[model samples]
Target: RKYGGAIETVLAHLQESEERLKNIETFEERKEELKKILAQQRENYLISAREIHDKRTKAARRFEKEVETNLKAVALEKARFEVRIDAPNAADLQSGNNRRLTAKGFNQIEFYFSANVGESPKPLARVASGGEASRLMLILKTTAKAGDAEKSVVFDEIDVGIGGRVAEAVGLKLKELARTQQVLCVTHQAQIASLADQHFLVEKETVGKKTRVSARDLNEKEKVEEIARMLTGAQITETARKHAKEMLGAAK
Candidate 1:
């Protein structure tokens, strides 16, 4: 009785098993198809990577030139800046020697710099001092045209190790940069502060055992007074005030 009632169920399972075995026998055929697809995809990837490499090379040349010019403006006239790009070429990709792929097409970029005359250019991170780094950042950030004006850029102590003419030049460069986008700069130099579209004063107050730090925007008169104080140490001389006024006036 068991064989009579259950024979159909056993036969159904056997049929399903035979279908699975058929699929197993065709596995080698599917593997070959997948291999062909992979080769086609790899060829497309190499072609696209090579195209990206060429565009990067063209842009890097222009970037190097602009950075060199701005370096001169920031009293880094003797400084040399380079945009170095390392990537596999079409020939390298064709030989299947470099099959590694990345999101950015296998291109690596680094900034090289020489801060003094007669010095060979080296990797920027290894050779740049605090002051040189500040100047270089300003040039790179301002000269970069890759993004929109909505991007906010902040520069802290950008005037480090610079004063007098160089400070004023930096202020001018900052002003030019601000014309396109939002820029916030922290500076001790009166020259830079005077050119700001808006100025905020940061003060630290000690209340009992606690210290409170606050920042408040300055009005026009307050801005002038603060600038004058920056020019003169303890006493704000008439000459300093007049000079500060002139600087602000010239900026407008």
Candidate 2:
């Protein structure tokens, strides 16, 4: 009876070993299946990212051309603008690939500009002047999808480093933009202020020892006089007023 009981115990141990081995095998199979599913998901993501990259490439080409044309309108006639989109380097790919993939897709974008003919295109930080930068920003805004017009867009002295025909162009562009959205522009140039549908003159007032700043909406006569003042500093000459009237009329 002792020998028989010992034999039963041995058989029990053998059965438990076999069961454990089967469980390990089942686990290995499940792990392989999970790996395959993960691989397929990664491949699908990569395919989608490549599709997005292609669409962005096509759009960038068109955007570059249109921005170059707009730059010409802003007096950078020789400027060449480029929208560069490129994939990450091989080193970045080897370091877990996740760094390259973003909500925007698996590519990087940088705006490049050549402000003058015969010059190589460089990043906007290195090449574009203040006026050129402003113009580029304005053009980008113009090209972007229209947003809620109730959102006011303010431009403070964007007309800096520009005057004459370029200033006129900027004013006209602002006016056009204002049709779809509200734009508030602070400019020393009479050209820009003249384009405003409503004009306000900012002044500083001193009462006793305290000085305060005030802005008042100008009437039509006041608007003309303000433009004349902008043209002739503290002096409002007849010629300046006449020129201001002509500018306002022409802007209309």
TM-score of 2: 0.74
Q: Residue-wise lDDT of candidate 1 within 1-252, one digit each (tens)? A: 433458887787779889999989999998999999988988888779879989999999999999999888888998988889998666777777755578778788889999999998999889988778877888887789443488878888688878888899999888888888888888899989989989999999999999999999998888888899999976998898888889888888
lDDT of 1 at 147: 36
Tens-digit lDDT track for model 2 on 1-252?
Answer: 443468888788789889999989799788999999987876787778889988999999998888878877777788888888989775765565687787777898998889888999999898867666767777777866464588888777578777887888888888878888888888888888888898888889999999999998988899899988888899789999999998887777
The reply for model 2, stretches above 4 Å from the true place, is 1-29, 89-96, 145-150, 204-214, 249-252
Candidate models: Cα lDDT each: 0.86, 0.82
Highest lDDT against the true fold, candidate: 1
Give candidate 1's TM-score. Answer: 0.80
Q: CA shift at 23, candidate 1, in angstroms?
A: 4.0
lDDT, candidate 2, residue 33?
93
**Candidate 2 residue 67 C-alpha distance from true site, Å:** 0.9
